[model samples]
Target: MSTEEKNPIIKIYMLGRFALEYDGEIILEDEGKIHKVWSLLGYLLANHSRKLGSQELPELLCADERSGDPAKVVKNLAYRLRCLLSDSGLPKETYIVQSGGSYSWNERLNYTIDTDEFLASYKRARQGGIDEQTAIDCYLQAISIYQGKFLPHAVYDQWAAHSTTYYHRLFTDSIISLYRLLEKKETYELMLPVCEKAIGIDAYDEDIYRIYIHCLTKMGRHKEALLSYETITNRLYDEMGVNPSGELRSLYREIMKTLKSVETDLIIIKEDLNEGGQAECCYFCEYQIFKDIYRFIARRVNRTGESIFIMLCTLTDKEDEIPSKKYLAEAMESLKVSIGKTLRKGDLFSRYSHSQFVVMLPDISYENGYMVGKRIQAAYKKNKVSKVVTMHYKLQPLDPKHF
Candidate 1:
């Protein structure tokens, strides 16, 4: 047999990192050197079926540089890439073919790229008409092959950037599809690790989190599901400055419904509710819980004729502009402590936005509510928070008729 026939098929990985493997040996680019050789080679290989014009190749490879001789630069890089392949112990043959003024990858090379297999598997899985198990197998294969975004090292390159987005979308779609199949099969345990892996690759994908949480709940791991929900929600707020979608919020309600066990004894329920110990300050809850509390209070006001007020505390710069993230975070923390200390335990508060908090004060007059807001500002200053952050407050009476 010829050397090429006897050797293992060369494998090229282009997902998380660029690499070439042959006969148990792996090749990677040198860290300190410019990657023109690898860049030229990767582009050619990615478009192997068609030839790239010699003039176009230089511009594509060195678009940012003002090369004195673009043709010579392309020639030198191609030579270096050929040497790289030769030194890697493959059969000595031309990998880049030049015809007239255009270059193309050798069609006869025996090699496989991860992206090719990934795309094929993804297409097969989504084409439908296949059996459930077969479709699932295809999806799992594609998911396993997709370690990360395509050409991560060349993300800034226009071509690589477009391909990166395309592949990432495919990977996320496969994950969602896999979840549906697994869910239909009622294989919650099998999906836990898959969802975890998917989340690691793309943390901001709410659909993956929803599927993960659903699987966890199905396995009766209510605490884990709740923890995941809290984690994603906090990350979304802190990083993206947005709230969870209504679908995610609805899923949270489902988790809460399943989290509690059936209990007839009021004493046990009371103990469960008081497990966190005596309240040392005002009640702090999620925005959803705050909404529920506000609604209940609005209803109760009609019967008890008690006064209720809502206060909005906003953090801004001296010019009344929103503060920077660092300042806003520190000021928000300090403000939380201040509100907890100044307000009565019966009062409720929640973070209303990236730079604001909402407080509900029951059984208090409008004047008292305003005073409470001033007390919070005073406490915030006493804590020696940054002077750049300014606190602004607005109060409105809670009217039952508006409920």
Candidate 2:
């Protein structure tokens, strides 16, 4: 048997986590130790195809420390890395080679890198004239290989950051291409899991969520699609302090439209409408729903000649400065509850910003609106809310002509 057959190739995983697999045994870096050892190893492996000068390694690896002799530190790190490889049962001499004051990963070593294979598979998948199944198989392989960002441990490193971005873009593109191909084949169910996995990898990616929701809707799972949309939108708002994109919002509307089935029984429709039970106070809805209510009320004001006032409640520090995120979030929740309990049942309210709430009051005079705002502030203070958080309100008349 050849030498290659006698020993299995060393497998290095830089995605999600950095690990080494040799002869079916996993090797991990020692935590809380000198990070340069592993950092050097990762850097060399990342640029394995090219030779890196010893002088350059010192600057990159020891950029923060100015007290030591950088070249000497790098040399010692190299020696320590080789010892680590040998201790891990890898042929140390066959892995990292030094010549002319430079180091390079041994090209002839029996080794495989997950990233190299990932890129290679992706390139093959994109080649012209390949059969659809072959392309799909390549894409699936590539996706499976990319567990997460490239070398997450070295994410802050400039080189690693660039590679991470490139690989992630490629991975997302692969998912999109795979789903489009599945759509062509009329096998949307198969696309569901792929899109779902992609979302788990990058939850903030709206495009992946859009595709996943589309697949769910395509399979007649409108409820699941709607739930997914709600879950993502809530998460986005809570974490990023922003709403979903227009595309995702439009998708949500489409899902809601699909969920509406023609029901002959008026009783069933009424029950569905009152599923949340009678409102004890103001109607609290999502911002989008609140906007819809605003428009409807604006149109009605022209005919009924009823006055409507919109109040914006803002939370700030004692000095009128925006508080910290944690404090602001807590104060906002308290403000929401206070407004809900203080406003009338016909009133509408929604969160307008990270530290603001917009409330709608109909059939109320301007003076009454100001009084209502004060009532909300009093309720909020009576609940023993943070003293650092102070409430401020401004009232504006909702003009029907603007609608």
Candidate with best TM-score = 2
User: In model 2, which regions exceed 4 Å deviation?
Assistant: 1-3, 29-33, 89-93, 276-278, 317-323, 381-389
Name model 1 segments beyond 4 Å from true: 1-4, 29-35, 83-93, 317-319, 323-331, 378-389
List all candidate RMSDs to the true structure. 3.0, 2.7
Q: After aligning candidate 1 to the native by TM-score, how far in Å is the CA of 82 from where it should be?
A: 3.7
lDDT of 1 by residue, 72-188 (tens): 888888888888888877767787888877888887777788998899999999885889999999999999999888766677778778888989999889988888888898998
Which whole-number lDDT from 0 to 100 does residue 178 have in model 2? 89
lDDT of 2 by residue, 13-66 (tens): 987778888888886543525577888888888889999986788788778888
Name the lDDT value of residue 44 in candidate 2.
88
Model 2, CA-based lDDT: 0.84
Give residue 229's lDDT in candidate 2 (0 to 100): 89
